[model samples]
Target: MNGLKGLYLEDLVVGQSASYGKTVTETDIVMFAGMSGDTNPVHLNQDYAETTMFEGRIAHGMLSAGFISTVLGTRLPGPGTIYLSQSLQFKAPVRIGDTVTAKVEVREIIAAKKRAILETNCYVGDRCVIAGEAVVMVPSRA
Candidate 1:
């Protein structure tokens, strides 16, 4: 690890993983809507959401996906890592009060580019709510 508390490129290995979790809340939903300007009724209006396929207000998919950022930025390759790209698939609704667990595992590393590809996923209990992949650039020790 570096002094910044992040793994240097040389320190990472395929299959290494880390995770973090948070419970979605009304405050979180409201605040996210404000910050992201994603006030979609399905996420904020219970009545409208009730008519949707999910049948009730659901937390923003991006909010659950943010948990993946938390894992990559604060754990695993950590603080100094720079995100190159991410692709996510929303698998299920994340309801208020559901605890979402985000996990990221290193899948590949390119030494010349000092980059890593990771498998990212978020779960509510045993049910997967989000699945994705991320590519990040890690600082080189040399």
Candidate 2:
């Protein structure tokens, strides 16, 4: 999926939003756990997970955060955007096969600084699984 040329700082508008979705698969959970060194039993061992409140294995929280990155870096300001910082809160367990949709909306922009602040969130059907904000420096049209 190719994205169009990115929007420059001057082109952003408050309240604008973009979204993308992905199904959390077992492979995705395993790979993310391996790559991130998050070997927690709740994410890697279903038997262990079943003993806990979630009832089964859950995907890494950061894995759901990556979906938010996809929307910010590919759909909004896009390609040339520079990610500055992000703050996130994990609200719910994302089980394998659950479809997650990430959404980002322009919250504020500092034009002189070429920066933007956005509200970021991920949802599973009607429930919000993650909520956060991101600061990014968007490229100039020049």
CA lDDT, every prediction? Answer: 0.94, 0.91
TM-score of each prediction: 0.96, 0.94
Measured by TM-score, how close is model 1 to the native structure? Answer: 0.96
Reference-based lDDT, residue 113, model 2:
90
Query: Which window of ten consecutive residues has the lowest lDDT sum in model 2?
Result: 1-10
lDDT tens digits by residue: candidate 2, 115-134: 99999999999899999999
**How many pairs of residues collide in each model?**
0, 0
What candidate 2 gets wrong by more than 4 Å, as runs, is 1-4
TM-score of 2: 0.94
Q: Residues 1-142, candidate 1, lDDT per residue (tens digit)?
A: 5547799899998999999999999999999999999999999999999999999999999999999999888888998989999999999999999999999999999999999999999999999989999999998889
Against the hidden true structure, what lDDT does model 2 obtain? 0.91
Q: In candidate 1, how many clashes are counted?
A: 0
Model 1 residue runs over 4 Å out of place are: 1-3
